[model samples]
Target chain A: METVVQQLLNAAQLGAVYALIALGYSMVYGVIRLINFAHGDIFMVGGFAGLLLALRFTWMPLWALMPLAMLLTALLGVAIERVAYRRLRQAQRMSLVITALGVGIFLENLVRLGVGPETRQIPSRMPTTPVAWLQDALGVSVTWDKLLIIFVSLALMALLWAVVHRTLLGTAMRAVADDKDVVPLMGVNLNRVIAVTFAIGSALAAAGGVFFGQAYSLDPYMGIDLGWKAFIAAVIGGIGSIEGAVLGSFLLAGVEVLTVAYLSSNLKNGIAFGLLILLLLIWPSGLLGRPASKKV
Target chain B: MSLLRLEQVSVAYGAIRALHGVDLEVREGEIVSLLGANGAGKSTILRAVSRMLPLQGGDILLGGRSVRATPAHELVALGVAHVPEGRGIFPSLTVQENLALATWTRRERRHVEEATRRVFRLFPRLAERRTQAGGTLSGGEQQMLAVGRALMTGCRLLLLDEPSMGLSPLLVREVFRAFQEINAEGTTLLLVEQNAHMALKIAHRGCVLENGRIVLEGPAAELAGHPRVREAYLGEAGASSPPCPGTPGSSR
Candidate 1:
């Protein structure tokens, strides 16, 4: 029972990181209908941004450093949209996809060249002591860092929910998702809404990158693997739904962690992907995604 | 001076020209209807005036200043609201959210609330469904929501494209009655419709667009009685039909 509880905690930590990254894919897709294939590289860039900020400002607390890194990474995400994606908005979908792939490759090479092909970790600032209550009563070992990661991620997600559901800017974002052409008719600047979407999505991914670095290690190419996993999570939970992404991430992480723990570690990817395929067969629009409605 | 003017405006969709040097005007507090068959370029004129499509030549002026280079979004602050074809409401958003979105340019909380209350008053059905998702509404209710949303922009001029399309005759009457009320309350209207019989009844002035040019323009009553318009648009059989030029069935 204790071992099961430990595994669940491990799954929760990994799921939190996945949820943070998956939200970007869902949001950007919701507004523009573009897959934004370069999103994974943005995660990698965010990890580096966090690492650089931590190294440069050693005295800055993790709370302060994380936001600064997010801001820096958000700017990069906006710049990428402006330089690489905006012009091809009216062009063919294939052209946009190809451009996104090119941008991803460009970011990967840029990071690899700048930082060299070396794996690095963010210096751990989170409290590493196990929870006394859990250790004494439940006889399970769960570190403060892991708990902090899960709680902080949930808090961020809650903040995002409020922004999307309660605020005007968020309403405009939802409006853009529903019908891009009509949003401008309502006096909302479509470009400005899109830019804000990119900024928020990228910022969340940066939080994920920072957490991942603290928990595990960061490499320039880490985004390629983890990014795909998050993308899959977003796809599994309706691609445009914020809640769906979080749910999908946790579900995927739970399956993978359990498969590795009780079954062969090599079967983890196969099971995770198999579950996605099986779920899709039943709910083609995704678990929470509304089926595509035809425009009259 | 006219509140809105198109000084020989032309618009092209790529190689094909949709509006060919169309000249028009709308005085303040008037309902001007543009009537034509499909592909006759009625909607294109609205698109050009709203800045949805760039003009290939000439210019559009709103209240004397040239709006030829103005973007679509800035028109809202200038008190121009466009209710595009098919009732452009955000489906996933609730009725209240749909109305609130149009108040994007207005920062005053009091003004937004006042405008929203006025919209609900104008269409009581929408008030009942305030929390319901916009897509779940009936066609009539959705049209009301669309018009209500336009009102929320605090617009001086409302541009409506095919406001009567797809609704039953009774619902069409209800929607048009709302338009008349909206007009009576001091909002100028530029309405485009294939439902000429209904559009002419509410309009003070009317223009008949054929193949991108204003072939005929006059008082709405006069155009309603005109033999050519009677035959082509109103479905009245003319005594001497001359191929019914530019009607969808006769167009080459």
Candidate 2:
């Protein structure tokens, strides 16, 4: 029973990180229908940005460090849009997809050259003594680190939901998603809305990067695999729907955790793609994606 | 001064020329109708004014300021609201949200509120179904919502492209009546339509376009009675004797 409970906690922590990365994928797809294959590289960029900030300001609070990294990463996302995606707005979808892969490669190699390819551990800012205290009090191994991660992730999701549903910028985002040409007729600038979407998505990815760095060591190639897994999470949840991304992340996380705990440790990483293929075969639109409608 | 003036404006869709030096003018507080058949380039002229399609030659002046370099969205702030063909209503948005989006470029909240109230008064059916999704509205209601959204921008000029398309005759009449009411409240209108009869009925001046050039232009009554316009546009074989050769509108 304790083993099952511990695995559940682990799944929740892992799922939160995946959800943050998946949101970046889902949001960019939602507004522009771009797969943003380079999003995982943005996550790596955020992790590196956070690591540099941590090194420069060793006395800075985690709260300050996280947001500063997120801000810089968001700016990087906007720069990517301006320099790379802007000219290709009217290009074919296939061309955009190919360009995205090129961007992913560009970001990965750029970081490898600048920072070297060595894996680096982020100094732990969170106290681990709480895990012992909680385990002693509850007679079950409940860690404060996992709980804090889950709490922060849920809070960010709630904030994002409010901004998307209640704000004017959110409405503009949805309007552009529905019809890009007609949105300009309403006096909403298409490029600005798209840039804002990229910024927000990248910021979320940065937050995920910071959290992931705290839990696991960072390497230039780390985002390549984790980013793909989060993308699978976004797809399983329905690529364009925000709620579906979070739900899919948790679901994939649960599957992997359970597989490692009971089924086989060897099957841990393979479970995400395996489940995605099975779910897609049964429900092609993902779990919560709106069914494709005919264009009028 | 004219509210909008198109001087020697030309447009091409790749290899095919859509408009050939189309010269037109809309004076402030006047309804000027551009009447034509399907390929007459009536929609193309409106697209040029809205800055949707780039002009290959000539210039469009809105309130004496040239709009040739302006982007499409900036035209709305410059007091030109275009209701493009097929009612460019954002279907997934609610009727109220659609109206709200029109006020996006407006700087003052008080002005936006005032404009929104005016639109609701102009079309009360929109108010009754304000919360409903725009897609779910009936054909007539969607047309009203489209025009209402244009009004929300507090525009000095309204450019409509085939507003009567696909609407029932009764709804068509209703929409035309709303156009008159909106114009009476001090907004200038430039209407593009294949329905020459209805368009002429409401317009003060009318121009006929055939094969991308203006073939006739005069007061609405004069164009309505012009022999070539009558035959080609109104689809009528006239029994009345033709007007005298030197009559006011005949020579041009």
Candidate 3:
């Protein structure tokens, strides 16, 4: 039972990181129907952004540093949209997909050149002593970092829910997803809405990047594996639904945790992707996504 | 001066020309219906006016100023509200949210409550279903909500494409009655319809299009009774009308 509880905590931490990164995929897909392959690089860039901030302003708290990374990363996301994706708005879907992959490659190589392809340790910002209380009381291991990850992710998801369901911009985003062509008829500038979507999505991914860096060492290529896993989570949950992305992320993490605990650790990613295929075979639209209806 | 004018406007989807030098005019304070069968470029004309499609030739003037370079979103702020062929309401949004979205371009931001009240008053059915998802509403209710959405934009010109496409005759009449009330309040209407009979009852003037060219333009009553309009659009009932005394190929 103690081992199971320990695994659950680990799963929760992993799920929170996946959820944050998956949101970027879900949101961009919801608005434009593009997979935004470059999104994973944005996550890497975010870690680098945080690294730069931490190196220069070593006195800044994690709270301030994370937001600053998100802000810079959000701007980078918007710039990617403008430079790499905007002109291809009307081009073939394949071309957009190719361009996105190209952008990801370009970002990876640019960071490799800038940072010299060496792994860097993020200066530990979160305190470790707070975990002692939980460790003693519960008689099970619980790190402050894991607890913080869960709490921050829940708070961000709640805020996202409010933005999507309770605000005017949220309404426009939903409307644009439903019908991009007709949204303009209602006097919405599609470019502005798309930009805002990219910004919010990228910012969330940046937050996830900072968290991942604190939990794990930062490398230029780290985003490739983590980003793909988060994307798989988004797809498993339902590509366009926010709730689906969260549910999918948690499920993927749970499966991965259970596999590493009871089975071969090498089988963790294989099982995560295998479960995605199995779930998709059973319910093609993911868990929470409604089947798209045809318009007359 | 006319509120909207299309001067020898031409549009094509690749090699297939939808509108070839199609000249149309809608003066202020008038309800004009563009009547045609499917593929007659009726909807294409509305698309061109809304700037949804680029004009291959000629120009579209809104109050004597050219709008050729204006984007589709700008047209609404310029006072043109286009309710597209499929009644493009955001299905996931509540009925009230759908109406609220229309006010995005309205200059009088403080009067949003009044604008929403006007929409509710015009379509009391919408008031009852204010919290319902737009997609779940019955077709007639969705149509009502679509028109109500347009009204929320404070548009001086309403461009409706196939407003009666999927409604029962009773619901169709109810919508046209609402259109009449809307026009009486000083909004001009340009509607394209396949239900020529119903559209004619409310339209003040009408134009007939065949193969991307205007075949006839006259008062609604005259166009309704024209021989070719009957042959092309009205079918069996049209054959009963007596030929005019002197005009051969009269409709053209």
Candidate 4:
């Protein structure tokens, strides 16, 4: 019973990370209609930024590290957009896709050049002492690390919801997604909105990176596999929907974790993609997207 | 004084010119009709005035100042509201949200309050569907919503392209009557229409465009009585058409 509870808790933690990274992928895709292939590298950059913050700013509390890291990561995102995505805004989708792939490669190489290619650890700043909680109403022991991860994940998602639904920028972002050509008609510069999208998406990816570094040791190539996984999560959720991405991430994360635990031990990533393919066969627009409308 | 003027304005798409060197004017508080057949460049004139289309060789003056290079959204601040071809209403937004977007730059919350009241007064059907998505509105209702959305911009120069298009005869008359009311309230209007007879009836002055050039220009009553205009637009036989030059537009 304890093992089952522990397994469920593990799945939830991994799911939380997937959800964060997936949101970034989905958001950037929603506005630009591009997959932002560099998004996983964005995660790596964020994780590194968080590590720098932790190492450099020892005075700041552990909780403050997230907001600070988000700020830095958002700035990095805007810079990346200005350099990489800006020129290709009106280019063909394939061109943008290749550009994004270039960005990801550049980011991985840059990280390798900046820091050695060895596995790195984020020095734990917070208490890691396990606090136990009841699971499944069966009084099974569930650890604090899992609960903490879940709590932070929910809080971040809630914050994201508020930013998306309540703010002027959010409205502008949704407007961009709906019709980019009409944005200037609404007195909004499309470039600025696109920049903001990159900023927000990258910032979120960074937060995911930070949490990931804390939970597991970081590597220069950490973003590559995680990034692909998150992209799959975004696809399964519906690439343009916030709720769909989150829900899809949780489902995908659960499938992967449980497959490793109970099913074929080495077929973890394989099972996730298999689920994605099944979803595509059934509903190609993903679980939440509106069906495509034909122009008369 | 004229609030808007087109001084030999010309527009081209690729190598194809849609508007030839055409001179036109709109007074500060009058209804001016641009009467044409489809492809006569009537919509192009409105597009030029709104700065949606670039002028190939001439100047569009708004209140005596050249507006050839002014951006589209800036014209809204200058009191030019363009109800573009196909309405261009945001389909995802609700009626109220569309109206709010029109007034996004407005101050005097009271003015917005008053505008909302006035819009509801003008379009009660719109009020009935204020919360509904714009895509679901019927053709006539969408026109009303389009007009209502334009009104929220506090524009003085209202450029309407084919307001009477796709509406029923009854709704058409109702839409024209609403324009009459709007004109009475002191907004300048540039009305573009393919239905020349209806257009001439409401216009203080009318310009007849053929193949991208203004072939005739005068008071609406005079142009309405012109033999060629009467022959082509009223679907009656002209002097060139028959034994009588005086036979056309005598009914108007």
Model 3 chain B weakest 10-residue run by lDDT: B243-252
Top candidate (DockQ):
1
Q: A87-132, model 4: which lDDT tens digit per residue?
A: 9887899999998999899988898888768888777775675664
- The residue pairs found clashing in candidate 4 are none
| lDDT tens per residue, model 4, B115-229 | 9998999889999999897778998998998888888878898989999889999998888888888999999889998777788898899988777889889999999888888
Poorest lDDT segment (10 consecutive residues) of candidate 3 chain A: A127-136
Ten residues in sequence with the least summed lDDT for candidate 4 chain A: A181-190
lDDT for residue B107 in candidate 3, whole number 0-100: 41
Of the two candidates 2 and 3, the one with more favorable lDDT, higher being better, is 3
lDDT by residue (B1-252, candidate 2, tens digit) is 688999999998887788899999999999999987667788889888999899999999987889999999999988899998888877778898888888889848898789878888888899999899898998789889999999988899999999999899998998999899999999999999878899999999999877788988999999999888887778789535422222222110
> What are the chain B TM-scores of all models?
0.94, 0.92, 0.92, 0.92
Query: How would the candidate models be sorted by TM-score, starting from the highest?
Result: 1, 3, 2, 4
Flag regions of model 1 displaced more than 4 Å.
B239-252
RMSD versus native structure for model 1: 1.9
Show the lowest summed lDDT stretch of 10 residues, model 4 chain B: B243-252
lDDT of 1 at A216: 94
Question: Taking the tens digit of each residue's C-alpha lDDT, what string does model 2 give over A169-210?
Answer: 888887777777888888888889999999999999998888
Q: Taking chain A of candidate 4, what TM-score results?
A: 0.94
Give the docking tier of candidate 1.
high
> Higher-lDDT candidate among 3 and 4?
3
